[model samples]
Target: MGSTGDSGNGKAGWWCRRSSSPSSSSTASSSTPSRTFETRDPRTGDVLAHIAEADKADVDIAVKAAREAFEHGKWPRMSGYERSRVMNKLADLVEQHADELAALDGADAGKLLTLGKIIDMPAAAQMLRYYAGAADKIHGESLRVAGKYQGYTLKEPIGVVGVIIPWNFPTMMFFLKVSPALAAGCTVVVKPAEQTPLSALYYAHLAKLAGVPDGVINVVPGFGPTAGAALSSHMDVDSIAFTGSAEIGRTIMESAARSNLKNVSLELGGKSPMIVFDDADVDMAVSLSTLAVFFNKGEICVAGSRVYVQEGIYDEFVKKAVEAAKNWKVGDPFDAATNMGPQVDKVQFERVLKYIEIGKNEGATLLTGGKPTGDKGYYIEPTIFVDVKEDMTIAQEEIFGPVMSLMKFKTVEEAIEKANCTKYGLAAGIVTKNLNIANMVSRSVRAGTVWVNCYFAFDPDAPFGGFKMSGFGRDQGMVAIDKYLQVKSVITAVPDSPWY
Candidate 1:
């Protein structure tokens, strides 16, 4: 395992600190205890910035601000087309500052800047624009009943929402949770992960530029117990949206019930499976699986870390996967050529290492990279473990690292059984050329999203939420707005006096 360093004050020491200009200086109220979270460059361990922590009082203030904006501000009351204009302006601002946003995301979470710019930032902005276009398109339906009256339904905003984002893709998650919430005429209080909160705080400034009213989108950066728990359990908060571990998701659900039975949407953990059959295209499966686990250092919630291959082609797949894992360049996130960056922080790095050690102890063969490379930074080599059983910890648990556990299956039924063995039902992928097999496996898998030939494929127009323990409510698409609004039916009598 990697060495652990305690900063005495409960702060992670590896964070980087960057110099800030005078214009960036803003303080919370005197009553709120001011604390700082340091940001670090994962490649060099250099300080990027020290961001202020928003405590419970700060969360309260942010939520109150959002509530005030929703109830009284002009933002929620603006016409959908008018709101679309603001969203478009926000999209323009995002494009103008794409480089900056990518850089901040890279420095904060060690995501590849090239991919962050080419994929994450543009996709994020597009999500904003897509939801912005839909802002005016939210429609309610009229009921045709056997009565002398006419009835229609209205979808109205639920009120203040609290969005707690994970660290893997902080900037994207921020927009994914915030954009639609605002478009639905709901206010938001965001609590970004403490490990990577700088970019989210930076976004508060951007939201202001996008003409978002004060408190409509407020960001509070602090520990999960402090700011996150407060927001999830706050009685004034009408809904809570979270993306993180399953344990935390359950906690949030409990907190919501303890508060006001607030509407909750959770995109939680996954031990997603990727099955490659004998008839599948070997190279493409290898490529997709590599991208699935190694992208973002395999920190993604929907990472296809568990790969099951048919016995006839298992060796070929393993060899190809090992070679692909070796080619993943682990270096500074800022470098365009770098394919894999360091884990988000040291704790995460060590956690991944601990899991690798567990795999070794459980008699799983470590086929490829397992230890950290380079003298500095929190870089773990892309690890591949073969001879893994469905019962092994490596295959059952969510590692959230660049570790792939290879399991072999003899028949289609065995593969399906193993794939659906875990508590997670988030996402899964199947690689095969046979249409019958594809259709059968797709129907059998208990995941929310199943990819027939691809992995990690996402769109703003699609509804994404897990089935079982993975939690409830969708994040993107038209259904996402449903969680933020209430449905009410209005009935009026016709001019005919016979009904009276």
Candidate 2:
């Protein structure tokens, strides 16, 4: 395979190459790529790298390599303890190259370089090490059954997984999906979002250096309609792990069913709510709520975009929120003090601006910061809207941007009712002094993960996913490894068994 070596462009070449057979390897199609796409720096719209666009043929090659790896390579056949050592080594490599990886994500996806260094990079390493610790712990149960047969269950890797990650947190999502699948002894064909493929290709290189077999981890950088659709629908891919929009999640599910009925786990979209009760501290509520929506320019799936505040504090919260939005800095991602970065690309930038206009047309009062910043790049100011009705477009839809919608409710019942009104239920946040109110609302709300008095409190041990239109299956816990595994029941008759 044409691994991560520099071509004439001074950028890394395609991680996976087009091959005549599973074992054979060659460069891309010709001296030049049949199709090429430019990955840009979201802060300046400067060309970061010219990526070779992978098509169906390229996808086929990657899938075949992964299939061969799972079937014949040493990865799947290795003992859990042996696999754990390699995974731990990979984790060490991630930590060593944290700064470089963080820089790549900042330029490619417009992630805050500080956040990329402190939170995103470290978090990726933590997840990898967490799953590495879990690799040696994957075991099945010995069952007691009727009759003279001895029965037990064997937990085995579900071969050849296809991992399609979003662009928002490329490094984090890469480890989020790839780490557990690798720990579970399954080879993977990862299709990183087109906007941010640099770090993923680098990670593929790191995996090889960490002693993962060549075919064990393959990355194909291309658009979704071509590379993504092919990976989702490939017959040799036994399972698919995807993190993206609900609409595309549905399409992947349908393709999985129509093709080979492969196991699919999707972590999709969210129109999450942050509920603030009357007794809550206004400063704390304002701070956490802003962090929820404005972090990562609101590209996060679990962003608390729709905020429900009690009537008593609605006026005060909205007042402080406006000041906060106005003061929130939007600038170059590499700046140490920049609070938020630009949208991943022009498409998301336009989508968010269009939604802000829709919110205005629908009668929601735009309080402050609805405009874009800078003469270049896809930068948008932190926006706040008050008097947002539950039925309005901004409140109902997942406008993934630095936009917040504030609505007021009178009572706990009303808060829960209005919060649950949305079709997506990925995550929610509750801010209250009263523990009883927090418990009541947390139990009443239909979200997969609820944070009380905090927001974006993600941990490797805690499982995260969605309910309803937000999509299904959990990620980021011990349960995550199960998504890449299959349970086989083994039953054998004893020497004196009646059946025998």
| Candidate whose lDDT is highest | 2
Candidate 2: where is the Cα deviation over 4 Å?
1-33, 495-500
Displacement of residue 306 (Cα, Å) in model 2 is 0.6
**lDDT to native, each model:** 0.83, 0.88
Provide the lDDT at 294 for model 2.
98
Model 2 per-residue lDDT tens digits across residues 308-408: 99999888998999998888999998999899999999999999999999999999899998899999999999999987888899999999999999999
lDDT of 2: 0.88
Per-candidate TM vs. native? 0.93, 0.94
Model 1, span 345-427: residue lDDT tens: 88889999999999999999999999999899999999999988888998888999999988899999999999999989999
Q: What is the lDDT of candidate 1?
A: 0.83
Clashes of 1: 12
